[model samples]
Target: MTDTQQQSPQARATARIIAPVRHGLTQAGALAVLAGLIWPAQAACIAWVISGWAAGDTALGRTALGAGLFALGGLLRAALDARAGALLFEAADRTIARERAALIEREIRAPGPESSAAVAALAVQKLPMLQPWITRYHVAMTRTRVLPLVFLVLAFSQSWAVGLVLLVAGPLIPLFMALVGMAAEQASRRQLDEIGGMNDMLMDRLSALLDLRLLGAADRAAQDFRDRAEALRDRTMAVLRIAFLSSTVLELFAALGVAMVAVFVGFSLLGEIGFGTWGGQMTLAQGLFLLLIAPEYFQPLRDLAAAWHDRAAGISVVAELDALDAADRVALIGTGAATAPLDGPLSVDLHGAAALPGRAVPLPSLQLRAGEALALTGPSGVGKTTTLAAVAGLVPLAEGRVMVCGQPLDADTADAWRARLAWLPQVPHFPDVTLADFLDPRGTGADPWAALDLVQARHIVDRLPDGLETRLGESGGGVSGGEARRLMLARAVASGGDLILADEPTADLDSETAAQIVAALTGLRDQGRTLLVATHDPALAKALDREIAL
Candidate 1:
């Protein structure tokens, strides 16, 4: 076994993906071995009946007993095989569910830049490939190791010549398989990446359909989609061709091995070959039994060869998931902090705080008293947002200390500090739910209408036929930009936090709406909230208690 920590992502993923199904695999392997053991008995019974018939023994009772034993052994083997298949499929379902859950959870916790569309695609599309790998391929792999040896031992006990033929052919099968499998692995990885790219392209085009139509580029976009689809189909055919060739090669060797064993057994029974059966001539019954067991020896190897494609696809999926899990972007602080409501306003102090060392923005140190309002104004792209993000602990700090509520900000205290704050981002994300649900998903909070009224955005709810019950699309679809801003402001007002952070709150609004937003900010200040606003609006800045230029 390889050291787990030192293993590559594909290796690590294989280990974890198998852990949930380990017990099931063990049980299945046991059943398979039991079935293999039963096969030799069945073969022996068939040979005994055939030999008795050839000798012209008219003993009906002995023949009947041999036939009955053959039937019983065959039935037992079939039952074991069926039960093992059931166990493996059930385990496979559970394993897929567990892995998907982990991938989604990891993506949810990932930093903003690290959580891309590829992550979602891998979780939904790529991860399911592991199902076949576990259920069929992995089961076949275990049987290939166990059953072939059992058959070989039985064959050797009956006739060593047959055993030697199997031993020679079996090693050749894997050697050829290995050569084919290397090419298959590379093709499988490429195919997976191409499919992922296709998914992303389709998603992007669908999301931008309206824009493309308006710009008269819809025809070009459709052509691109067709081209990508064709390429994916071509790649898929390549993978299939390799898989079929591998199966064909294994089948050829297996047939050759079986043929050689059969010819050797026939010659030995005729006394033409004299070197295979414990230094004595082989009897017809023993020769027939060895012939019957020869094919069984090579069956496991053939099954494994058939499942090689699944192994390639599964390892590729694992590598993709590992890449998603390995993202190292800076994440939010205070995610695990205890929640405690603030009694009053919060005081924030940033000492020599700067943007992350290599970033473009370098923020200056600043201090604010409890219940104070400060506006951050500068030319565009001058670290205005970066300053607010650093203060909010949304980004990593490289050269300064942030003291909040008289305590230095660290992971332990970050959550508690964030609980007392409400942030209004430049771009808001809204799920597909009722307007009421957008305001409070739990449906138990301060009246959403009252918050909208304070922001002068009550007209938005009134205009909708469903009022607060009106459903929005993703990213607040069906709402205008100004309306979206007001909705976010309404949310912050309803949050009842002691600190409010607003970014460009009135950027696209008319003078009337901008004044209403300013009034809302003034209202928050009067309510003992410490406010930080990053903006370029002179009117909004003049209304604040203090101004800081980056």
Candidate 2:
């Protein structure tokens, strides 16, 4: 087995992300094991007092000392247990928050492990499952490793028969747990995968709810949701069933071990049996100690069995994290962060660049000087937008290089090159923030009324309840398509970038709306701002300075 495979399930699965928390887990486990070991000393004290009383030497001082020592051990155990619990909870919380933030930040800057909805489900719902495993499983695992052996030695120190019974019973629980864990991990993984899929389905249906209403397919949507829900429920039940079965097995073995020890100790103390004890016969104190210590032997094993399912679930979540790290996606040309503009003049040039990285679908050379407008005219899949994206340094090229604003569009200069341009995508998205914040994302505190008036969109904003402070939904919920396009244009104008890159700016609009958008593009070009538009509209193409057919 590999080094990772040899580690515990949680470690093997989550080591990439959870490394920082492992030390905390170890510290907490040591404290828990220390607390657990005290129970034996406490039991010994109680046994000594009872034996003294049975000998008719019930002195108050002796009894008080024994009781005090037992109480002190109990208090010490409680304190250690409480401290371990606190540390474990803190460690788990810290790990969860850190992973969630890292997942979200990485997704924002790069392509994520899954869809947006699935990523959301994983970050918000699925990740917290690690807490139970971290808090319960690791401590139980520690106890199982230490307490079982210590209890066996202590049992053998008193009676051979009880020790043999514990030895036989203890190993059985771990073996059974190992068997159940294989199936439990599979079930937990399926349940988490289903959750992500269900979230994706819900997001898709909600996004297309209007279209579904128009087509009168709400019943089909509901049925699909019902089926997904049933699958999730079934997967969850499978995990639970495995957990219950393992728990039953653990309890059965534990009860039997304790019962057999009781029989051996009780019969020996009663002179009915004599072969199991070290001194040929069991005393009252030995009998009491054996009965008290028998149950403690199986407690750690029971704890481990109970937490075995949590380990499976936690491992599945960790597996998801590792999957996210390995998933392939579009490579950003630069760091995809805001930076100062590169030193270059206002222009764009593409010399037979490929549409995608590691793909040999090259395009024609396109060049534009300052204050020129060019249209990329092609069919739907003719790489028009891809060409534009390549020029914008949003996608990498296979062979030829793109020069933007006199700078090579590579990782070193892509962010700076992009800072000198504005992009208007086919569909505009707005965060749930005020229009002022959306338009002035850099928080420059500039007046946007001029840009808004320039694009003929001030009238639309003037009618809104909050005007510049209006908070728009992600899809610009209350805004018409043309109006949203106009708002994007205003942002571009306000951005003060010399080049404007628009993709299908005139698509899905009426003649008047399309004309206004076209006029706005023409106006930007006339004002000495460079323009590159990908469009099929003949009017939009004719209005531009020249057209490049892909």
Candidate 3:
């Protein structure tokens, strides 16, 4: 089997995402483990100085040498730790930046914004949790793997009794930590899921704030938020409890190990016990060295226990990344890049096209020449919007091809073809830009006033706080649905494209407003702009030259 296939699922996923950024990780982990190894030498220096004093051989130079060695080891260990931390954090920063950029870049051109909130949560909050895992947990694990064994060897060399106590206790700490880590991983996974759900709820609620207020459901929305908050709080607390429990278990075993070692070393030095030692005797130096080494033997275990939760959380986050990366969704074609308009006559043809993933819905072959106004009239769920998007190059086809401007549409031609099209979607969306910019989104130098006048939306802009300078967004900035439709028509007029695609533009508008929208669209046809409208409104469809009902 390949390396990743041999590992557990979470570990496989975690390693796949993290291994790419692990350039200096090995060196960093080596540095951290080396820092831990320094303690044994420092402990030796202390033991030497104490042994000299106990034997009445405390010459000034010998004592100074021991003190100097201890100080130098401390400084060297500190430097190693600091360098390792810098490398690890740098790697962590790179990893987060790379993942966040990839997620945003992939989602920006999607046909639907349905998962934007959850993706935002993943980008902003969940992805950063991997940082501590890379920086702390891995280093701790490396030290645990090496330092305990080194200390065990040193302890056995001095006295087997002390080594025996550590040998029994160290294994149990890791065994218990392994068990606790399972629960930790489960809790962390739930917490991450809760966080995504929370963001999704908040975004959905904010988008429908106006409707909720009008429907007298604001209190109900507030209650929903409170409930989600409570659930998140519970999930967070569950993780914290598991972390605290693991630490408590580690400390209990660590204390017992150290205590047993201390008692054995102390009694051996006092001549109360002699059988546990190799020489049947213990000197002050040996007793002191073993005592100093006792706590240090469990040091790596302590560090590992402390960072076990981070490993769990990091694995959960990586699994999340894997899920998002593997998820198969219907995304738009093209780089969504700005391009010069495709150079061709305005024409559209669909050859047995169907929406992505499957071809259950039949989209028959059709042809439309320049300056034609065709309506795709159909009931809901008849793939009207899908056909419009397919023609616009915003949705990919599974079984057939779309020709735009006499060119077969693919990634190579989608952006350029889209440059020549104007899409006025069912629910109007505006960026947080000035009204003038929104009117001329492509910066075609088209007169905003003229476009507004053509659509009869000039009166709507006159009521705005800043006229053409006013900023608005998807909520329409207090503009009603009909007004928003008129404004979008104005934008389409300003964009100065050859083909206009209007989707349910008058679906919820009143009779007068719908009539005005229909008039503006017919006016566009009079201007020789080809119109492909997806609509259920009979009057608007009848106004066009021909209709194709799906």
Taken over the whole model, the C-alpha lDDT of each candidate is 0.80, 0.87, 0.86
Candidate 2: the clashing residue pairs are none
Which regions of candidate 1 deviate over 4 angstroms?
Answer: 1-24, 49-75, 78-103, 110-115, 199-215, 262-284, 320-327, 336-338, 346-413, 417-550
Write down the worst ten-residue block by lDDT for model 1.
107-116
* Per-residue alpha-carbon lDDT of candidate 1 for residues 1-550, written as tens digits (9 for 90 to 100): 6387589755786687877678998898788878878988888888888899899975989789998998899899899999999998898888888888876665444353332566676777778888888877777878888888988888888778788888889888878887898789789889889888888898888867867998999999999999999999999999999998889888999999999998998888888999987778999999889888888888878877877778888888887766655555555566644477533347888875454423435786789876789999987767888877777777667667888888877787777777777889877667777778778633465578877877778988898888888887666777787788888888887776678899989886798878878888888788777889999899999999999988
Best of the candidates, lDDT = 2
Q: Which ten residues in a row have the lowest lDDT in candidate 2?
A: 353-362
Model 3: per-residue lDDT, tens digit, 247-327? 988999999998888888778778888678788588888888888988988988888887888888988988887667666
Each candidate's clash count: 1, 0, 0
Worst 10 residues of 3 by lDDT: 106-115
TM-score of predicted structure 1: 0.66
Sort order, TM-score high to low: 2, 3, 1
Instruction: Report the Cα lDDT for residue 374, model 3.
Output: 92
What's the distance in Å from true for residue 329, model 1?
2.5
